[model samples]
Target: MARVLIAPADTRLSNLRYGKSYNVLNNMTADDVTIDALVGEEETAVEAQNVHVRELGTQNRLQYYGRSFRTAAREIRAGSVDIYHHMNLSYRWFNPVLLAGIAADTPTVLGPCQTGHAIMAEEFNNMLSQAVGYELPLPVSNAVYYPMNAVRDVTIDPVRMSLFRRTLEAADRITVVHEEAREAYARHVDESKIDVIPLGVDAELFEFTERQDTQTLVAIGRLEQRKGYDVLLDALANVVEAFPNVHLDVFGEGPEEQALREQAASLGVADNVTFHGYVDQSVVRDHLARARAFVHPSRSESFSLVRLEAMAVGCPVVVTETAGAHEMVRDGKEGFVVPTEAAEPIADALLELLSDFELTRAMGARARERVERNYDWRAIGQQYVDLYRSLL
Candidate 1:
C-alpha cells in the first residue's frame, strides 16, 4: 500500500464540524493507500500512532510565518512518505510543506484552496455605503480602491506571495473545489496544473427524513458579512408578509450575530427568525431533515459542504448563482439559484417552495439523489487515490 502523508493546519482534527480537513483525511484511507498526518500541535490528550504533532509556538505574526514553516519543513523531511498532500494552502502558511515536498523529491498535491472573490469587495462596499447612508464619489472611491486592489492582486504580503508562487510552481497537481476557484488559482500558476475536485459530504450521516409539512427555512453557516445573512434577513422580511407562520432557523455564530438580530428586529421579522447559535451536527441534520427548504445567500463560497449536507437530508436548497455548490444543484430542478445579494429573488424562491408542497417534495428528492450520485465521501476519496496513482 502507498503511504501518503497528509499535512493540515490542525493535527488534532479539532474544529471538524466547520472544516473538511478531518473528513478528507479520515475518508482517504483505502485498500490501495494508507494515511499518516503531520499536524501543527497536539490539541487533545488522545494520541494516535499515524499522527505526528509539533508545537510551532506561533503566537505572533512573525512566529506564525517563520516558526510554522521551519517546523513543518523538519517534519516533512524526516518522514519517508511517497506522496505529500497539503490541505488549506494560504498566502501565509504551508510554505514549509511545499518546501519539504521539494526536498524529499515527492509528488505534491496542494489543494482545494480558494481565494477572495472580486465581486464581494464591490458588493460589500455598496452595502456599507447603504448602511452608512452615503455613497462615496465614483472618482474618489476609484482613486482609493484601485491601488489597493492592485496591491492585493500583486501581493497581500511580500514573503507570503513569494512562498505562494514557489508552492504553485513546485506542486505536481493542484486541486480546487469549483470552477471559479480553479480560475482564481490560475492567476498565480499554470491553468493546466489545476483540477476541480469538490469537497464531499458524508451522506449516511445526513440521512433523508420525510417532512413536507414544515414551514421552516434553514440557513447554516457562520454569521459573517460575506455570508450575506443580512440579505437573507431582508428576504425573510418579505417572506413573512405572505406566510406569517413561516419561520427561519439560522445555525452557527460569528461577529455578525448581534447585527443580524438587530436587522431582524428593524425589519419587524424578529419573532419569525430563530438564531440557534452553533448547534451540534445532529441538531443540524435534524433541522435539515425537517425544514421545508435550505436558503444560503452567501456572496461567495469555494464549495459549500453545508448545502450538500442539506441536500443529503432531502432538503431543497435556494442559493446564490455564484456559490460553488450551485453547480451540484440544477436550478429549478433541485431548487432555485437567484442573483447574489438580491432579496426579492431569494424571497420569491423561498415562497415558491414553501407554498407548493408537491413541488418542494419532488425537488428535495432530486436533491438527495444528486448528493448520493456526486458528493459521497467514499467516491471523492477514490478520486484522490486515482490522482495519486497517476502521479506515481
Candidate 2:
C-alpha cells in the first residue's frame, strides 16, 4: 500500500470546488492507497474524513519560527510518506506548497494546476478599469496596464526559475486540469511527465433535478471582474427586450459587488437581475436545478466548476469557450459555448434557450448523463490512487 499526503490551501472540504472532490478522495481507499494531509495553519482541527489532516506551520499568517514548515520537512524526509500530492486549487496563479520544500524532498504529484493562461492586454486593462474605476475620475487603467505582464515580470519567471524548477525536477508526475495548461507547463518542464486530469464533481450530490421552463437564468462564483458578470448583465439587458420578464440570479460576493450592481443598474437590467451575494451550495444547486439555464461568462477559467455542477443537476449551461470546462460541454448539445468577453453571443444563446423549451430540456438531459459517466469523483479519485501506485 502507498501512503499519500494531500495538501490543499483550505482543510475544510465543504465548498463545491476542490473541497468536494478532495472530500470524496479522502474516503476512497481503493488500490491499496492511504491518504493523509498537511495544511499551512489550521486554527482548530476540524472533522476530516478517512484521512488525517495536520497543520504545517504556526497559526500566524506569516511563517512563524518556520516551526510547521520544519515539521513538514522532517515528515517528508523521514520517508514514511510515499507521495506528496500537492493540490493547488486555492487560486489560479501560484502554489506556495512547492516553495515549502516538501515537494523537492519527496516524490510529488502537483496540480490540477490552473496556470498557463494568457489574458488579453486590452481585456485585462478593461477588467482593472472596472475593478478600481469606482472613484477615479480619469481612466487610470494605463497607469499599470496588463497585470499579466506585471505578474510575469515580478513573479512567474523568477518563481519558475527557482521554486517551480525544483518541484518539476523532483515531481514524479504533474497533472493539469486542461490542455491549455499543458502548453503553459511544457515551456518550463518535461512535456512527457505532464498529464491532463481535469477536476471532478460528485454527480450524486448534485443529482439531476427536472427543471421548469422560465425566463430565469443563473450565474454563480465570486462577484469579481473576471467572472464577466457585467457582460452577463449586458446580455441580460439585450435579453429583456424580447422577454421583459427575463430574470438573472447572481450569486456570491467580492470586490466587484458594487461594480456589478452598478453595472446592472446602468445597463437597465436591474429589474431583470437579482444579486444574491454569498449563497450556500444548496441554494446554488437549487437555482441550477430550477432555473432555465446556467450562464458562466468568465473571461478565463482553468475549469469552471459551477458549470459542471450545473450539468450534474440536469441544467444546460452557456459559457465562454475560453473556460477549460467548456471543452467538456458540447457547443449546442450541452449548452452554448460563446467567445470570451463578448455579450452578443451570450445574449443570442440565452435567446435561443428562452425561445425553445425543448432545446433546454434536451441539452440538460444530456448534461446530466455526461456528468454521471465522466465527472464522478469515485472514478476521478482512482486516477489519483493509480498515480500514487505508479510513483511508488
Every candidate's lDDT: 0.75, 0.72
Instruction: Return the top candidate by TM-score.
Output: 2
Weakest lDDT window of 10 consecutive positions for candidate 2: 59-68
The model with the greatest lDDT is 1
In candidate 2, stretches whose alpha carbon ends up further than 4 angstroms from where it belongs are: 7-13, 16-21, 40-50, 56-69, 89-106, 116-156, 159-162
Clashing residue pairs for model 2: 56-68
Worst 10 residues of 1 by lDDT: 44-53
Error of 2 at 117 (Å): 5.5
TM-score of each: 0.81, 0.82
lDDT of 1 by residue, 1-392 (tens): 67666554443345357446655655554566666655544444223333344444432334344554554466557766677777677534345566545444877888767765544444545534543447755455556566766786566667666777888888889888877778778888899989888888888888987756889999998887788999999999999999999999999886689999999999999999999999898999899988999999988765678888888999999999764655788899988888987999999999899889999999999999998888887677668778888877
Q: How close is candidate 1 to the true structure, as a TM-score?
A: 0.81
* Per-structure clash totals for the candidates: 0, 1
